[model samples]
Target: MRHLSTVDLKVEQVSGVTIVHFPQEVDAVNAAAIRERVLRLLNNGVTEMLLDLTGTRFLDSAGVHIIVRAHGRSTALRVPLSAAIPEEGTVRRVFELTGLSRLVPTTIGLPRSAGPAASRSCSTARARGRGRKPRR
Candidate 1:
């Protein structure tokens, strides 16, 4: 099993959204870790999540499962899940091929003028309107 060499989860408060920055390769070996972390945030009252996959280099079936499950759970809980994916990359291709690109809100690359920090702020504001608290 190929393990992720570096998996970092950073929580930032954006406008009203809790952006979970996932900077790691997501494969079979470490997909559970990502699931657990996201579940923890959901339990902590995160209703709006923005997954930033800017640094991810690879994604496998297990990784896709994790994302699908998260999306399912969010729907059941009435939460919103969005993602930031570059136009061209392994991760982007995986999502596209799996037909999950339509299921999740995905943006091509980072916001043009809005940096990560600013995006976080915008997300926070959006989350607030939905009556969801931003997770730390």
Candidate 2:
């Protein structure tokens, strides 16, 4: 039941999965902080992660870099990482253009089961997009 809030992110845990809510803008100014927080979570042995970016309106290269790094680390650690990107917006577009969505598991919005059932729901959603598309 760990909860942590920083100037650029809000972190919460749901059924052993870590969910990170991004701010409206994730640029060079706050990207490092966000990256560090994510690193700490991974180092803490987070089994799964959801990068909730539905509220993000702007994300520069540095912000994208943070996600990329996270994906790499998570993959190495065997921790599943997913993202909640809006249907359409700067954030989504950035992910698409960068081909990041293809690399990570992603859903249109925050997973419906952010509660006790999140573990099952997240896995199901990822399986749904496994072969056909990039859920990230």
Best by TM-score: 2
- Residue 115 accuracy (lDDT) in model 1: 49
Each prediction's whole-model lDDT (CA)? 0.69, 0.78
lDDT by residue (tens digit), candidate 2, 1-136: 1223346477898888899998899887788788889988998899899998888999999989999999999999999998888766788778777777777877777776763223222243333334346458
TM-score of each: 0.74, 0.79
Give the C-alpha miss distance for residue 65 in model 2, angstroms.
0.2
C-alpha positional error of residue 72 in candidate 2 after TM-score superposition, expressed in Å = 0.5
